[model samples]
Target chain A: MTSLTPMVAELVDYYDDGEAARHFQFRLLDQQQWPPPEPGQFFMLSVPGAGEIPLTFTQLPDQNQHWWALVRRMGSVTSALFRLEPGAILGARGPFGRGWPRPGSDQTPVLLIAGGCGLAPLVSQAERLLEMNLGPVALIYGARSPEARVLGRERDRWQHKLALFEVIEQSPGQTARRTPLDALPDVLAHWGHEPGATFMCGPEAMMTALSQRLIERGIPPSSIWLSLERRMHCATGTCGHCYLSHRYVCQSGPTFGWPELELLMQQPVTTQTPPLLSC
Target chain B: MIHYRLAELAELTRHLGRTRQVWQRSGAKEWCQADASNPPPLEAGRSVQSAKGFFFAEQEHIFEFDGRYFRETLPKPAPFALIGVSSCDLVAIAYQDQFFASDPHYQARRQQALLVGLECTVPCEHGFCPTVDAGPAARPGTSDLVLHPVGNGWLLTVTSEQGRKSLQGLNLTTAPEAMKQQRQAQLADCERQFPDDQHIRDGVQALNAGTVNASTWQQMGVQCLSCSGCTSLCPTCSCYGVQDQSADQTITRRRFWDSCLYDGFQREASQHNPSDDAGARVYRFWYHKFSDDFRKDFGRYGCVGCGRCEATCPGVIGIHSVMKRISQHD
Candidate 1:
């Protein structure tokens, strides 16, 4: 999806929260050249002054307005993208990476776990699953708070197809609030195990804990899939920055299953002193 | 093939230096004096760095992009002949050739280089060239010319057409008995210094075949600072990042070396970190060297056992030692 294409669309709507922001709609400038994006695919959006960044597709599988990117203003690339107006030129190439599993009766019930921005891809997957009429899907999402939660406008769209649970960590803007990871037990119990495949995306600590909990609940290792993020210099595998044990996060995966638990959970942590994040 | 006296050899090295700075491969800046016990004036030991610095320079520009224009350019390279190169380094160069030469951008820069090989009379203690079939000495196609120490003089074998031209300017001697004797002694000395390479291959094999847990890798992590020193010193590691520089209208693209050990290397715009911890990052280094892709490309292992990384590493976490430890584990 990273081929250079001019995408111009109506700036339909824009919403901004401090940490992340969402663009409701974007027009694909070159619709004729726009290639179809897989459900789990992503696009590399290029901003002139800043640089290029990878964002997951959020608008439904084959919906209108070309594509959508959920940008979190944490880095230089996204911060630059956030400042662009509706008609501004945003260069994009992608819709890359392996997407969600094809809807099939061959598999059991499906469990989707998302935390914070982790919800981006799952939302895309949920929309596609409904179009295919594949169900009994459950969407389990955890966030710091309800106000910080995103896609409230799209709530009605999800409620009809998937059983949705939004676990908010804090009590409205309270300083002393719990994290969504702290409420894992309730989320797990609410899902009620019936041997279904699971897809999880979010922070590493949260994903690790969630996978462990699901494993204890008797879910098969092969049944759970995980999307991971590593530092990436070149979204192509050549840079080796995003390289994991035996995989390249940008190449082999941003996704894996329970069978790879050891590669993630068992590997030794690097001792290189990490630089503190400067504000 | 031709022969040259010690004085003639020294002059050739001086001439090569004019093309580019000729630091002896793995040689320290200082020279070793001749002792009564060791007659020939030998340069101290081999340098702890590889020839990688020449081909894939520590810092390189691929392209530059500014507001409007970008011109693609490579670093200005003066034709150079890297002498005293080990078989291991040559093999490592072979691996790099597969990488850069495969791409037209890299091939352009590589075409400007030359190789001068030297046979070792005394191999470095840490070097394990024979195990990977990289050396006790230079391979056939490794260099344009090979210099074998012969008695009081040297046996210079020209391996390429370019080497023959380079030798045209030199005053050389016919092969003599004393030179033959010196060559035999050098070969014998290398065998005595390091007899077999099976140990290195065995250790690497063990690490690959074993299923050691994360604790082992984590334990090794205590000493690692992720300084990127190890990666920088490794000859076969070819990972790099591309940056663009542009001004006014023309744009240029450039590539710089990158290490997997850095945290920022994998940090995404979303602030999600996949291998944020040390264990996952360290695992990446070992896995790449032993990965299926590296093996398929090189026909064996990616590491040539030069030991430069082990020597320069502040952490003292030798890849050879780690492979051995993993192999010993159940």
Candidate 2:
């Protein structure tokens, strides 16, 4: 019988990352049956008293069965997760959902777009590209402010190797609220190459706007990928909570090509409705 | 497939009740445990509540975690028989069987239950089962035994090996071969008696053609109180939410019936709600019930035309009302 019961994972360590986010490392008690998770795949973390919440793997599990994720203290489950001390036990089940496919090529430039805490799912992919010595790879990470930015450590390491653009809504502590779109022109100009594939995660409006712009710039919807977040209970796809139309976002994707995502969102209501800000 | 002269349904029920619990449809919406000697009348009416609860319980503890280990909780229900279930409900049970085929907890309860489907001889107030391919007569293979009322007794068609085995001790005479044609005639008459549901057919078309306006849905959505009444009463709605209750370090995870019409049903911990708009949630609920994409997976539309939702919904978004509104839009 397939079970929702999760194997115990103890928190090894954690440190404050962004404004209300923490970088957490955990070591699973049992790894004998764990299928190696691809970057961008997520897991369900159970806070003993509070319920379960889905989190992506910012860092894949290593030899010691230690994996890491960048978690924002968003609600009950994450709040409970943040309250626990190092070595505190929690439950986890996953490596669920479709992850990012391999980049087209190291020689083919890849563009990365992220908004605020949305960077978590794409951070590992960026790091892997950097490690591969892939050139012309660019990242545009938009945040409310410098302090509101995340993965500061990962950014610092990639600065010399990456075509990085840290676009903030409020620049130098305070400025007119700008957006990633305001910086898209300059970022693309500097990269000076049409990206072969674009990976994105962020606010719904930001992702949709960027995807449209990319498609207008000659990128096929098939080559543009984005990670979507939805409410999920049973990651096994039995529970219908995470439906992106008929498809379960927890099963078929958290990551999807723009074309596939567009097709899934073809329900009449979605098109008629204006974009609403999504967390 | 076999025939039997059921001299008395009570006699057959009595023999089966010896080893298994027998629950027969009672009143308009309950299945009361029956006394073998005096079985309740098996009227050809719909049950607002179905046999769904017998397998996929409304609330259940799925698992428990106690510091060191997590243990799953699977129900072990005793062998039971559902007597005089209407055809629409039996079809819903068949649909759930395929959906929860991999779910062990559902299987444990399902495997022990023998379904006895009762064919409708006349249309019930809210039912239009024939329109959705569910029936006045039970569809073949949906139940273990199908009962068609004939003369002063019943014609029991044994559809499964389990049904045949359970009837071994019943003192039934062989039914006349002409009874089969008589059974067919009664079912056809019942089907013809169902009021025309042209709106339902047109609404299905309008829905699949994507012609219904959001404004119409919003109007209907406004009437919905999110009381979860329709979903609660719906036989095929299988969405659920999980909760964790902890005491003395033991965390027990419980799952309860959840409705997609509720705003929080698809709300994430990040406070992002996929169906934040009531209209969207309303549309999604109907979409799940009537969408052709869903039909491909379940072999039929999610709705069995039982009209439980129509009977229970306090709002105008019940199947009939919504279908009329949407089809009118077309």
Best by DockQ: 2
Rate residue A192 of model 2 by lDDT.
94
Please state the error at residue A240 of candidate 2 in Å: 1.7
Measured on C-alpha atoms, candidate 1 has an lDDT of 0.63
Q: Which stretches of candidate 2 lie over 4 Å from their true place?
A: A30-32, A131-135, A270-279
Q: B231-327, model 2: which lDDT tens digit per residue? A: 8888888888899998887889998899988888887776667688888889999999899999998889999889888888888679899999999
List candidate 1 stretches off by more than 4 Å: A1-19, A24-36, A59-66, A86-95, A172-195, A269-279, B1-49, B66-84, B98-104, B111-116, B139-188, B195-227, B241-255, B261-299, B314-330
Residue B287 error, candidate 1, Å: 5.7
Q: What is the DockQ for all candidates, taken in turn? A: 0.21, 0.62
Task: Report, to 2 decimal places, the DockQ of model 2.
Answer: 0.62
- Point to the candidate with the largest TM-score: 2
Candidate 2 residues A172-275, lDDT tens each?
65656677777788888887988888899998778988888888888777889999988888888777899988889998999999998888877655433456
TM-score of chain B taken alone, every candidate:
0.82, 0.97
